[model samples]
Target chain A: MSDVSSLEAEVAKLIVRTLTLKVDPAQIQPEEPLFGDGLGLDSIDALELSLAISQFYGHQIRSDDPDTVATFASLRSLCQSIEKHRTK
Target chain B: MTVGWLRQRERGSRIASRFMIWMALFVGRPATRALLYPICVYYLIFSKQACRAIRPYLIRALGGPISRRDLYRQYHCFASTLLDRVYLLAGQGNRFDIDIRGLDVLKDRVARGQGCILLGSHLGSFEIVRAIGLTQQDIEIKVLMYEQHTPMIRDLFRDLNPAVADAVIRTGSPNSMLRVKECLDRGGVVGILADRLLKQDQATACTFFGKLARFPAGTMWLASILKVPVILFFGLYRGGNRYEVHFELFAEEVTIDRRHRDREVQRWTQRYADRLEHHCRLAADNWFNFYDFWEEQR
Candidate 1:
């Protein structure tokens, strides 16, 4: 549980850093949406975020992959995906 | 920004398009081209919205008042390109004389095995490039476009060559960028039309033809993120089955600094608008975005 939370926190920081969002990583809710109305991240952000994830975790979050939508749903889901697929 | 083009309904019916294709293929190029005169006149008389939308552009490009003859020529130019799509897509490109300028630029990229972005506009026949690619088996062209917008024309052309259909990476899909990235990684050329902007797109106001008009910054962002070479392509149609396909190396690499992202995007888009303007002057009738392009004026 602690490991998962830490991974989530790490992903939150990554997102904030990659997007240069004004909000603090600690303030981001695990269950809050990362796109659309929630985090307000657009498609360009998604591309940039995917690149960052691939570089940092060594796993490409492909759009064709069925798990992509679920993976990008929120910080928790994204962390879970990283935990499952991260090669590094 | 007013997405007038998106709001404007697609003009022709599927049956009409299919019939036109059948006529084009059966009757052949020259005979079928004669039919465009009546069709062009029909549109010039009827398509009031298109006329109103294009007047400003024609005035800007021609540097004078828009006359009926000028409008007819514009309509005829567009209709000619549309009819030629049948020949171009059906593997009958030999019928037309294509004057390809800057083939060396594309050949050099292919030689390097470095995937690049071919940034094009709606100025002329984009399909003509695909026809050129058919001769060169080495060049793999994948187009990123909004396929949903023009389903009738898209489906008709797609059926002409299933292989070309397969090369399309439809925009607005979640995996569209992923597919583009994969294609680029494989040293494949991805063609993108950077002229028009969707409602949700991030746009930068650029000085186009001395007016501050918004152009989508997303393509530049994608190029920067993927770190690929961008080549500006304009396939201008010269009357009587001749096409001047020009390719200019726009940027070796597009880099956006995080601190000045907006300014950088505007700079790149302005450069693109400048190139597009230059080409527009070269072929005034070739300007195909038959919509109120300068939303600011509206």
Candidate 2:
């Protein structure tokens, strides 16, 4: 797998575990959404997932970030941003 | 999958509110309260959406079949609070006898200069809490509100009291969380209504009143992340100018272990739902969300 794909899978696992999402981590499509009308994750999940990401990678996901919409758009997009920003 | 209550257009007009405010100051409360009967009758007859929404709540709360009289009672109770809000915000709040239960919780938190979350619901007038804060100036309060959602009511209240309006932290702004954190850092109590789902993103399905319903998790998550105490508050309308404000210390601090964050959120959210249910049962007529609460598909 490409580095981006592996990153997406890693983040997908994080999302599933943090949110306790019903779907399997392997089943989360790389291009699938993580928010409204998509994976159906809510704001609580967003906060929880952000904390997990911060703990794992030392990168805090700022809710007030200007590009928050695109940052949380999909598994692939989120992982790309995470890869760019992750401190660890 | 119907339109949520928060999305519904406010039924009262600005002109009517202005007129009522003038009438409240001039005619006084007793005469003005008499006016509520006809107004409530009008809502009971005309506001189909509100009527339909309130029925299930009344049925569950009353523990039996509901009558037109019961519906009218709920409307009248709401109207009474609305009229009182005009007086409350107008700085004539001393006119009513408000019994505040569990005030020590607030006093202790503020005394320690520790910021906390005052989580309230739609059951009664949050204005009562503001009224309490107004009287006790030492306890600073800030409310998180969606200023644009209810323009008519928001504008009316703002016109009534500019000081209160200035204290509002408008939701959805990029710096919204920043403002909240700043206020908390200063040991100011930040108030948020956690019962209703304002948007699809803010909602989480939780069991309420023996059925699954969507409740907002923003307040709980924010409190947990900030490591602030969560205090459940209710300003229940007790009919005819009598309001009771109850404060229960919900959590000293919300601690979410990374391994169990989702479960922790659900647990906290359900605890709030449980408290809200208790208060709703205590003051059935005061439960005032005028749209189908259980409308969301779980």
Candidate 3:
């Protein structure tokens, strides 16, 4: 599997857990947009994601920046940002 | 309706009502989904007289057309919101999008360590702001809050998300004020939700929604005295978990002159108000003030 594909599998799990999404984890494509026309998450989910990232891996994900849309643009990209900011 | 009879009845009923509210919060049960309903039904069933007495106040405060069904729904929604808040508070997760803009503005002021005031409003699930200190912003936040009426719910909130919970400074207490001053003196930030009116001699008339409405002047007073840079923020909730946390420097800088103090605050407060309203209009449903808003105009 490509590095990006593997990254998305993990993020899909997070999406399932955090937002209570019902999709199969493997079905979440790496490049699929998480916010729009996809998993159907919103601002509260963003806050929950912020809390999740901060607590689990000690990384801070900010939603106020445009990067948020980009990072969360695809599961793979979000993982990359998480990998970059992972405190532990 | 003897005065003595009414007073005794009031005291007796308050004690009983408080007990049930406490039970719902602390002890979750099978009928938990009906928590708010049971209480409202209790009131309607037992306290028919009180329901009739307070119906007008409820209609006016809620700014809604009155019907028993609608009122019940409103009351029930309020209860559901309270319950959901409690449940979320119990389990705060990690991995959030705490996007920031103009953070440098807040950072520079906090760097001065003069204990800045982080004025916020209830446009978004600002409970999300608890993620601040735990994330990019290193400032310790002390929030001033009016304790929720129910003690059981209050305790639940106290444990929701420790990052934010630990930072809260309850309002109307000297400790809360001292903590604000202490954070300021240490060059930290104090978060205060200033949009809502106070229960007492606390608010001043300010223009909102194109008319005069009550708003607290405390943000101005705090800014003038502590006189730190007041940063205004609004986490405009667009939908789901999507929020735009727009930040601004309410004032580039402030002066300590007593003469210009009130107008200075009004000027800056107006700016903050303007920004807040702009975002609020962006997502009316997410604005989330189910209770009375613009009480004076309405």
- What is each model's TM-score for chain A? 0.92, 0.88, 0.81
Worst 10 residues of 3 chain B by lDDT: B1-10
Ranking by lDDT: 1, 2, 3
List the global CA lDDT of all models. 0.86, 0.80, 0.57
Better of 1 and 2 by DockQ: 1
Local error of candidate 3 at B73, Å?
A: 13
What does candidate 2's lDDT look like per residue over B74-96, in tens digits? Answer: 99988898899888888888888
TM-score-wise, the better of 1 and 3 is 1
Where is model 2 chain B poorest over a 10-residue stretch in terms of lDDT? B172-181
Interface C-alpha root-mean-square deviation of candidate 3: 15.8
Docking quality (DockQ) for each candidate: 0.50, 0.11, 0.01
Write the number of the candidate with greater TM-score, choosing between 1 and 2. Answer: 1
TM-score leader: 1
Q: Cα miss at A70, model 1 (Å)?
A: 3.2
Q: In candidate 3, residue A45 scores what lDDT?
A: 51
